[model samples]
Target: MSSVKYSTRVNSFALGKGKKLPTGNEPILELIALAGTVPGLTSLELNYPEHFKHDSLEDIKEAIEKAGLDVPALQLRWPSPRFSNGAFTNADAEIRAEAVQMVTEAIDLCASFGADHVLLWPAHDGYEYPLQMDYTKSWVWMVQGLQAVADHNPAIRVSIEYKPADPRGRTILNTTGAVMNLISDTNRANVGVTLDFGHLLMARENPAQSAAMCLQAGKLFGLQLNDSHGVADDGLMVGSIHLAETIELAYYLIREGYAGTYYFDTDPVRENPVEECGMNIVRMGAIIEMARLLVRNHPNLPTGRALDSAPILWETVMGGKWNTTVSV
Candidate 1:
């Protein structure tokens, strides 16, 4: 079997204190060079406005090319102060328009790079308290804004990477189902969902089941792979905490033949970025291998009762005693 392709966050190479920059780290070009040094890294996932803050689009593209890395994806990062209220869901129409324009720009750039799609995290598109947001109006605005961008360019895809909550206490499009609903409301072929593993865990979702849902809908456009503690977007290394879930997710993606790149959306604050990414690749490869083993051993594993399936799965994954007579 061919080895799986991998990509990583460019910002992970940036060395700086939290929210503070200029920590004597390399610039984008040098950072791209460093990322290229990573063994298994094949592509680079960049941010639109954030990456553009210092370098021009042409410069960024040239750097990636020089690094021998392809830009498979670009994420939109709306500044907090300006978009604290919201992006597409902002009450201010002007701010909302600006956010939409940023997304469109990212889409156009993504097309230029021959990338897969542009991702919208919408970090600010959420709520903090009850009555803090006009749910109906915000929902309509989000749908219309996303539709406008999807309609703007039919050649490229626009993916929504939903998070349970982060800059706010409660976020819109917090779950895979919610993202599916948004895609349905948008009603665009090019619109899809970016299934983030950490985000799914934060929402207390089963990553494999969520992948199945997206795959069933044919809307699984992108993947941001990482592990979490089921409470926050921890951005831990893949398979670090929830090994079984990650393995199951890999099984579905492999068995169902997902053709998208796996971007390591991790934050390695204390560890070396290159080493952290390399470890992620190793762990993910192991998870995929385990999943492949399960497929080879138990092709119809989940078709039967859970009680019967537990021993097979446990033995297949752990290679140890799984008491078949144990009562659950």
Candidate 2:
């Protein structure tokens, strides 16, 4: 099994109202510096539009270099008012064209930062009324736009994220299966899927199963870490709930030789900004540590055998019957 690595998403809200970093420091530079302070973090995932202004890609790259941290991936929050409340699917041709340009520019920005992955969460692209939406037309527009973006920058990978809904009525790409179908239909190598744990929980989807399926489909490009209770997209710390399931998913990644950044993408809405940032690092470290322990302790667990026996194993471990079943 491969060793697990961790990375964190730098939430723009954590920067507070500071216009610049103190004593000859740029904001991006300061963020990279702060990221270095977190233990076991190999890379940083910067949110777009907020943390990464449209014209600051080069400066961001320079700051990342100065802080000696790698920018593995970027999250592109499409700067469209239509993105506010499930409207991307119904956006006009001009608005859609602008979105395409925004994403293309973001891809270029990612390439400039030496990061190949670009994550797109169409969180507000769903329909409140099922009958009001033309599924075929929306899918055509989405695929066309995405293909254009991919063609514009073949070197950069674009990942679509799935979310059931939150702060909104619905989301278009709301499930792993839906995302997989989109990728399949698009048939573009540069396009893939971003598996966000919080979104999976929000959709009542099993994270491990979703991860496994994405892996099998070869659509998984990156990962987002968070926790929830099968209800809302809480964005809680990883492994805070369903600890055993999380570990099992980690083990699956290790077995599959999945080489991608494990990014901690959380909301700063609940806790103190500074404390939440620090806690994210700590919680993410614990997740990696637990994953590592699972690989180490279960060295004899065959990959094929493990997949076949996963259900019973999960029930036994996560179902809280570990001691009785494993006792000699």
Candidate 3:
């Protein structure tokens, strides 16, 4: 089995899968304790402003320590209702500046926790209709905003998480290619991507291919592992909906020697959060192990042509043995 570092969304514990919120005064602490109960859960990825709303960072850190969990990353959350127009690309100049400031604050918070990076999901930074947004100027503003955030803290990284559309008609960085381009344009070494599997699926992208691209580009900062039906950010557990793709992605991540943490950005609306997260860790480990087995069983499985390797691939994956071969 691969020695993988597992983390999960802390809010999942308190959200109660939309059933009920934690009644405690310090819900963040309670949530941390609940999340820590999951075996093999190595660390946590928490939100900045939202998670800090009730408890102080000191209290949260103390609770995390008590739970034997490390804070690996702090996600910046800017709800759409507050910035429906956009975030970095908001039409109002002050709101854009405020968004940038919020990112800088999140960076500071991340540094305080010795976290790797701040996950920035530009959820509200897109457009609704054609001509509803000023393409060129908005792009410029985005670059400028990102540049400002990068300049705020050169030592810390800022990983951009992209989504195709939701809470908005279309997001600014909707695709992996677009995110790569943004990173290129931002011209900042610390700016990278936190590839969400479901978001990639929604964009009609193959997660394995995107992982390979990001890994090769050296901009693959982290991964938000989850699944969906290629339509929304369903945030389902890994392998629940896209098992093969998850396995393939794991294969590529292993092949590429990715050493970053796997954050379970999932939603356990109806299931126990702790159990669901524990299952996620187990499923990913199994997928990674199976990927290793596949590579070992067939050295030339991905032979640049799907038809050329489909037979042995299926045999090993389905039959658990490479007993047959096809040359064509």
Evaluated with lDDT, which candidate comes out highest? 3
Q: Candidate 1 residues 92-155, lDDT tens each?
A: 9999999989888888888889975888888889998889999899999999999998988888
Full ranking by lDDT: 3, 1, 2
Which stretch of 10 consecutive residues in model 2 shows the poorest summed lDDT?
17-26
lDDT for 94 in candidate 3 is 95
Candidate 3 lDDT over residue span 1-328, tens digit each: 4367898887678655565434434477888888879999989888768788878778988999999989888899886577888989989999998999899999999999988589898888888888998988988999999999998998989989999898789988889999999999999999999999989999999999999999999999989999988888888889998898898898889888898999898888788888889899988888888888777766776888876676665664587556455588
Q: Which residue pairs overlap in candidate 2's backbone?
A: none
- Candidate 3's C-alpha runs over 4 A off are 16-26, 322-328
Q: Where does candidate 2 stray beyond 4 Å?
A: 1-4, 12-29, 80-82, 85-88, 268-328
TM-score of every model versus the real structure? 0.92, 0.81, 0.93
User: How many clashing residue pairs, candidate 1?
Assistant: 0
In order, what lDDT does every prediction score?
A: 0.85, 0.71, 0.86
Give residue 150's error in model 2 in angstroms.
1.5
Ranking by TM-score: 3, 1, 2
